[model samples]
Target chain A: MTEERDPHLARLFAEAPEPQADEAFVDAVRMGMARGRRMDLAGALAMSAAVGLTCVALAGPVAQAVGQVAGQVAPVMAELFDVPGGEILAVAFAGLMAVSAMVLSRVRV
Target chain B: MRPADSLRLSNAPEAQVIALAAAGSDEAFAELVRRRQGSLRALMRRLCGDAALADDLAQQAFLQAWRTLRQLRSPGAFGGWLRQVAVHVWLRHARLVRPPLDPIEDLDAEPAAESPDPAARLDLSAALAQLKPTQRLCIILNYVEGLSHAEVAASTGWPLGAVKSHIARGTARLRRLLSVEVLS
Candidate 1:
């Protein structure tokens, strides 16, 4: 603030003793940064594992939904693209792989 | 950083050093810390009025700055950005360890403790330690660090009115403690 300053206080602050840079302080910060990084990594891994477990727990329902959707869409696909029944399984597998890739991409691990 | 690496980036411009540090060069970050430690530590010392705690908090601030360095959009803004980081760290630490600060109305409940020693009389740290945490942070950020009231407001997440109030009252209290004659 323009009005916040006082000359006397400024002078005292100017006169305040400043600490010298210590290599030890630098080392301490370096160690702390490394530790912080490890903690971040561990947190990310934990979150990934939690997400993985959730996906595993939901896998049966998810697979069943996908299969049901594929079954309904397969007739339209065969009529539209002249695809056969067995090839519809390939399309379903490909769709499942694409969805799994998407889910895994968001896991951050 | 190697002892030889100390002088390597010492002479580089701050913006360039900041850019390199943002690029994840630890050496550059080291240089940035070395160049900045003096003022940052001094700011912490004035804010907390304790050398050891100030350094500890300053180091924590630097570690935080390092972790978030890549998010800095403007390397030229590092000084202000770093100060904001330091203030946040201080706020977090204060909130965790210290009792909630006395409300502004109650800030003057206790007169600054009397000290018989003349040295303590002359010591600004002793006087600063008498301020409530909010007042102390605002006073230091405004006076010592030369931040504007609005800047201090943004830094501490306090309203502009509150920052102005704290600085005014804190400065008045400091003048009274130091026996510095008020202009009024």
Candidate 2:
């Protein structure tokens, strides 16, 4: 047990290689976690949509009001979405905004 | 890095970073990865005895840490937690890849480190090679990283007395094997 303090062995242990993880690997793990969160949010949104559709089928007047609002907004939204890739860009922007909101809520400010 | 921007909580205390990481904070996880990578690499090198394998194992360990972070019992105990994860990663890989045994005979015949380059640290590595996989891991964790016998036991899931015995026996064998080169 006393010989356990042998400097040679200790030095060897100290000298053993210690490599650092690169930024790329760290980025990959972060991306994986973010992707998982995005998928979860997507699933929740889809489930919500399905439930909303079921409710709309059961409630005629409420569904009619929803349709009226969509009818009014659809033309403008359609124009905004008409450009090539515009719909995708808009969806991405909305997702980014939601993520930003979540992040901001967690902040001290 | 700004407080808002730095994201990596590595600069914070291990407990703080661990808690943040456990709660699903990417910055905290990144910080944990950055802070522990060096120690993990050193431990893996001793256990696997190959630089490349050590690198791969260290990478895999970080990935596992991400998946298992929430299961960690105490945020304050993250260092030991990471070490434990690394041991598991090494053992898991050991199942698939049979690491080369230590060349004890070659080591015994080699002279002391009079070489100019520190690359001769391979002598220490070769001595570690002589140890059985578990024994080598215990030695590295106990002697090299300076973990307590209980910490080693807890991390490796070995009994307390068994941990002591492994350390004592492994240290004695390594000392005898490297006595010539290490001592002279």
For residues B1-184, what per-residue lDDT tens digits would candidate 2 score against the true structure?
4775574454567788778778877788887777777778778887887887777778788878888888888776777778888888987787567654232322333334333443444367787887767668778887777878777878877776666766776776677766555565
Just chain B of model 2: what TM-score? Answer: 0.76
Which pairs of residues collide in model 1?
A: A1-B148, A1-B149
| lDDT at position A32, candidate 2 | 65
Q: Which pairs clash (backbone N, Cα, C closer than 3 Å) in model 2?
A: none
lDDT of candidates 1 onward, in order = 0.80, 0.70
User: Poorest 10 consecutive residues of model 2 chain B by lDDT?
Assistant: B101-110
- Please give the C-alpha DockQ score of model 1: 0.43
For each prediction, how big is the interface RMSD? 2.9, 2.8
- Segments of candidate 2 deviating more than 4 angstroms: A1-7, A31-109, B1-4, B7-11, B98-122
- Candidate 2 per-residue C-alpha lDDT over A64-87 given as tens digits, one digit per residue, 9 for 90 to 100: 444555556556556768798789
lDDT per residue for candidate 1 within B1-184, as digits (tens), equals: 6767667688888998998888888888888888888889998888887789999999999998998998899988899999999999988888888867543543446565566544555458887888888888988888888888888888888778877878888887787778744222
C-alpha lDDT of residue A50 in model 2? 99
